[model samples]
Target chain A: MKVKAFLLGVLALAGVFVGFDLQNSHGTSFAAKKAANYDESVTLPMAKYPETGKHIKDAIAAGHSAVCTIDRGGAADRRKESLKGYPTKPGYDRDEFPMAMCKEGGKGADIRYITPADNRGAGSYIGNHVENYPDGTKVLISVK
Target chain B: MNKLLISYSQLIITNTDEEHSSFQWSDEDVKRGYSVQRGAVAIEAINNDESEIEVIVGSYLPSEKATVTYSLPFPVRADSIIVTSPGAVTLPFSVPKGTYQLHVEAIPLQQPTDDGLFPVRYQLYFDTNGSK
Candidate 1:
């Protein structure tokens, strides 16, 4: 009778352990950049260009569709906040691609328009800088 | 040659009959500690066929003394604000529910030589309280 009681107790303990593991089991939870519940409603930083500025007017008028109007109001709110650190080795700058421009043939069409980090030292922007939106942000580029 | 300016912003508004009930946005209003001013041009769209929309841009100095305004032609809007200083400027303003054009302007305004511009980037809030 004692042996049977011991066996039942062991089974019950095993079942509890299994249940706990099941509750925590979700696929690929080890990934570094998964969006959290807090990341749901985020405001992205966006830059706007005015036609009055010389280079901007020239760029937009030159048919370079990548250049568009800037909304400084959007940029002001997004100035220099901590970003989710990506997996990176020390001393190496983070590899990033600006969210593709919508005007022309999607992305990969024009390389000249892209401002490289090497030429413009990482974040040293000479003129108006548009904070690149992270992947998966709903974007709206329009003409009014 | 272009100049670098910081600590300022270009207020873009889509005004109707009253001119106050419109959506306005800028970058210089928020980048605090760094000088925020007009920088480079982003884009320009012109309507040769007919008068479409008008864009008006002006520089808003945060303080009471230094006056600055770079108003654009009617209908030509701004998309970006150039950072005149090495850092950032922040502005906070509200927009009414309406379709509008946008742009930014920035110019680096400080060297080791000049006095630093405004402090603290402007935080955007609806004009329900009134302008500061």
Candidate 2:
């Protein structure tokens, strides 16, 4: 009887451990989504020569600019943000964002990556919310 | 540990100085005229920075048929004028041409602080091109 009770207790402990492991796995995806959140930062590539034409850093900045224009609502359907050829341009580069992120269940707001044909860029629907702003709102930003 | 923190600070400052700059607009200013049938106008403010720019567009409505008022944020000079819709639009001290007037202006930006970020806003007003 003592041995049987010990086995039953061990099984219950194993079940709890498995449940904890599953919960942790789900938490990792949420953390990844948060990590991908948009924050203002300039990107530059490592380069040895300043005289080099369009170094990697300059190229990276330009690439992000193209990717930031596709955040318009109702227009970003079936679109994606390309991260290919990121450090170098004039060469073929391809990227695609998860389609699930653009769906209704996704957290995509009024701004995001859109179809490549429509300028192949990102966009925002800021003008749609102009009604909520004050009469004289201004903003200054420094990017690096 | 103290030395490591100091080294990190040095790296951040050096990186920031080498890699950052403020965004300037493609054009110094944009100008548009308003007239009859033109109730509003829209203008785009370019954000050269990596972040989004929160800006506002608006103008004071005219009170008289031949009178015109300036926008809150005065422009340095007038440039190319496009008809937003249809309204009487005249430059500062210039003659008003039609029954109504329209003008598009960029207000100050509400910058985002450590506390929170502000959304961009725009306002549109119409005028009968009248004098007060």
Candidate 3:
């Protein structure tokens, strides 16, 4: 009876070890499968630049400007649009406004444009153009 | 004890137009007009391994709907390190005024490599309006 009990105890210990090994292998296999199927793709829509407005061109030609008072809701979008490229050339009769002056408080709009600097150094400029109006005032930006 | 290290990286914009100048960017300078017509990106890396490794540099512009991918093989000797200070690779296409995410990955050419090896990624904003 003593020998039989000893043999049973050894079998139980062996079974425990085998179970632990199986669990570890299964976990590793699961992790490897997950890593093998990793997806590294990023998708984004094509960016569209705003078109030049006919009125804006007319104003610029006439040495006048049109201003859009960017309401609070439109402030963030306007700020983003302001960072976009200046129309390659001002559109003569287009219906969209791609470039504009951005103002916060009673200060001038921050106008940014691509610089002609070397490729090894910085290549853009951000200059502030103070408008002669109070905060929340609409200012028109035009090329004279 | 083998590893890959990214030592340095930078994004450069070169504008051909004279009406604009480049300015350093600040965290609070999110109000835009910043723009760039061309971008040259450079990355430096080192391999501290006994075997050859592959390095991949990828740039993804979600808003502009563009992705750039390039790969190079790096050879390293046992008990020795390989350092690379590669020149900037000019993008074939212009990086329009928008934000972009850049990803870099390195892996050993041999099998039995760790899945979580060398990976790095970051975000950048570009504008044709010249805000650096």
TM-score of each: 0.20, 0.21, 0.20
Of the true interface contacts, what fraction does each candidate have? 0.01, 0.00, 0.07
Q: Identify the runs in model 3 with alpha carbons over 4 angstroms from their true place.
A: A1-56, A59-65, A68-137, B1-132
DockQ of each: 0.05, 0.02, 0.04
TM-score of model 3 (CA atoms): 0.20
lDDT (C-alpha) at residue A14 in model 2 = 100
Best by DockQ: 1
> Which stretches of model 1 miss by more than 4 angstroms?
A1-144, B1-92, B112-132
lDDT tens digits, residue span A59-116, model 3: 3455432344433323333433433342322111111222222223112233322221
Candidate 2 docking classification: incorrect
**Candidate 2 C-alpha lDDT tens digits along A1-144:** 999999999999998897678658878644443354422222211121121112222433443221222222321222222222222122111122221112221122222222211211111111211212332222111122
CA shift of A78, model 2, Å: 18
In candidate 2, position A6 carries an lDDT of 100
Candidate 1, lDDT over the whole model? 0.26
Model 3: per-residue Cα lDDT over B1-132, one tens digit each = 222221111222232121222333322221221222223223222121122223222332333221222222211112122221111111222333333333323232433222112233322322222221
